[model samples]
Target: MAAPEQTPAQYVPIGGDREISDRIEAYLAKRDGVDKLLKISRYASKIIIASSLFESQPLNSKLKSFESSVGVTRKALRLGKFLQSFNALKKSSELKSKRDFMASIASGGEGLYYFVEQFVWLSKAGLIDGKHSSRFSKIGAWCEFVGYVGSISVKWMDLSEIGEEKERLRSESDENVRELKMMELEEKEMMKRLSIVQDWADWLMAFADVRDGKGPLTSPLLLSSAGLLSALISAHKIWVSCKA
Candidate 1:
């Protein structure tokens, strides 16, 4: 599903002397962990109220239909006075999942084993879709994920292996476009057509930034993904010539 072009939605600002909103904000402000937020907002009403501190929707929808038929406490309604439950709607699902996924990955060192497990768990749990799901279908996504985490992506897998996988992913993405295009033949569909390519490009650039054991202050040297196999062959070509 496509994201709304509108700016991210947020809960209305808490006014002075408002207690429920203030309590929820104080409670949620301490919850830097999305897992906790997911649990708290598992229901649409809580999701609507607790999420005012940030821009997001509810979580793990199948956790219960309580998600849609959220019983708003009169207390909550009185506090916000303009909140929408947005229940039973899939419109916010994509946003919900991505927000959860990014927050999960922000740890910066979850390692490969945990990373794969995290991807599988998040996807199987239906916590993510759209780019998140499509990325799971790409080798580049895993490769890029290691960049965000630590050096869990050891230098052992060959470029040839990754290249072959990439070729297969490109073909799959093209097939997806062909399948989707028939359903949108009348629309301009600019984003629908370009999103896959853009996603792959973003993944590749992100994955190539191997810090090469340098400190945070150092320029990154693309770490070879495989011992003596060199994922850096292509990256090095551009690195040696670029003035950036």
Candidate 2:
């Protein structure tokens, strides 16, 4: 249910006088950190651009430009990100004789999304013809939507299993052991719930993309809010890992 790259990192304390700066540096050392920050900026810009506060035409233009610039930069950073999904798929396959259906779907869809995204970026960056951008963008959005659906399903299954395990733990007569195990399961349940929420947030944005920003649910305010929420969740997870 967790992200493939969310494996726990060893805890290492920052010992310098500039502890805050050191922590910031440490966080930015991870790729996800930068991506999440940019995502926040991008979505924030979207919200501001659509807000009544930015009624000035020139200001709105600048806001739109900033959002577009941040978006393109994020895409640039993800140039080879599809390989991460491929690696996830490979790792999953190696772990079991029978393939996990939802996992495979998630990984495959994610890989395809990122692969198509490269062209989208290239077009946006002016390195390629922009004519195909719309088509590629639509395809990428659908792929992302598919991936999120698979991810949500996988997480739901994990949450169910965790619930079952917790139910079994109820019969454990050892007070201390039962409490500790229950606590662990509670933490895991909380994490899975967070992951599902994040996935749904992203799925909303993907829905907007596929709809070409047409529907009422795909309104700028809604999509921007969803994108910002998803970015914050991602950032929180990455920051936690940095401190682990």
Candidate 3:
């Protein structure tokens, strides 16, 4: 007799908006206990959406048929649009002041963490492709966000260092006057970079919290991820300069 055919695992019925809202509430209650709850929440929401999209009979049937029939470029574009909608609120600019900017970047940091957690959940559940999944998108987005933040942090540190060097040069009244002038120029450039960094930082914070129904500005994961990117970039730059 032929071996019995293996059956696909049955999909569990997930609670809809009500369950999602309740989970969000529970997560918020323990927000302070964790370092980057906002970012984590963002990822969690994405995973939930992706899973729901995959499990629902109507949606999954449509998606599977579309995936098989569509070209790779078309599929990628569709995926990008799907992901972009989740963060559409981030493009707003109603709050532009420095204070508001900082608060916003902080929130973005938290959102990064939430997204990471969601990636993990989805991967474990096998709702998406493990090798080419939403996690990769999350990683890319995080790296880009953090890379900008890291650049700013490095510029700030570099400016501080250059400022001290310029002061020391000013105190010296020796034949190194020409060297002092060069140092001054270097300090000016460093300061300019720092200014740009600060402005970018403000923008990033605000971007994370922009939502239609929500208030502007918030994330710890975003902050940490950004910090990590900044550190890596700063280190890489320093290493390259040293090698040169």
Candidate 4:
């Protein structure tokens, strides 16, 4: 899942009466916009492939091929994505002075995940031996799962802090001040909740990967649904950030 911006939410303009082409251009101007759309399409294809509607072998084969193509393209787009996690790790480490274990787990694990993912992408792209793909994928999935665990823990802690701050602000005598602060906290809370949900969704997919699609819980339908959910949530965050 794409990380939501750490900045506080603020009002922003969006979707004016501009031409559809212009709106699309504005959206694609953001680096992650195309990737998010591809993610949605990739997972949507999986859902179709898993569904009973595509029972024919030929149709299913085509759908799977399309999904594979989209998945590979998405990976290509994330060629340097590890830098994001690395930068976050550096900043978080500086701020926490090495005492925040969860922070390290979140950013460090994600960095490792993305770093390892490059080889997996290469395997998929036929630049490396296909035999290493499974091992690389499993390692990446486990790292992603660990990263999400830390990420969710950190977000929950932030929500707890926000809740406490809101409690303190509730007693403020100034009506305007209270309302403004409350609104800000509410927005923050909403974003945090959305992020948590997205992480959980992504975590499910990671778990499926780690399991190598073994159990009923990791069925194609479940995995595809989780991926689609995470993709949509990511798209939502990116669109809102673009508007901002």
Candidate that would win on lDDT: 2
Q: Write the per-residue lDDT of candidate 2 for residues 132-211, one digit (tens) a residue.
A: 99999999999999998888988898998999999999999999999999998998898789889999999999988988
Ranking of predictions according to lDDT: 2, 4, 3, 1
lDDT of 3 by residue, 1-244 (tens): 9999999999875667566666555544442212223323333333344446356777656554443333222222233232332263264224465433433453454345344545544553467667755445455356335534644554565566667777777666675785868666685765457455543743364345232113433344343344334333333333323321
Backbone atom clashes (below 3 Å) for every candidate: 1, 1, 28, 0
How do the candidates rank by TM-score, highest first?
A: 4, 2, 3, 1
Question: All candidates' lDDT scores?
Answer: 0.35, 0.88, 0.45, 0.87
lDDT of 1: 0.35
**Deviation of model 3 at 87, angstroms:** 32
Model 1 C-alpha lDDT per residue in residues 1-244, reported as the tens digit of each score = 9976997788775664476555555544432222223323433333333335334444433323553332122112223211221221223335455433343333322233233434544553566563574344244235444433322212112223444544455555477775565444323233222323333333343444333334442222122112111222222322323332
Instruction: Estimate the TM-score of every prediction.
Output: 0.17, 0.86, 0.28, 0.87
Model 4 ranges off by over 4 Å: 1-15, 19-24, 94-99
Candidate 2 residue runs with Cα over 4 Å from true position: 1-22, 93-99
Instruction: Give the least accurate 10-residue stretch of model 4, judged by summed lDDT.
Output: 12-21
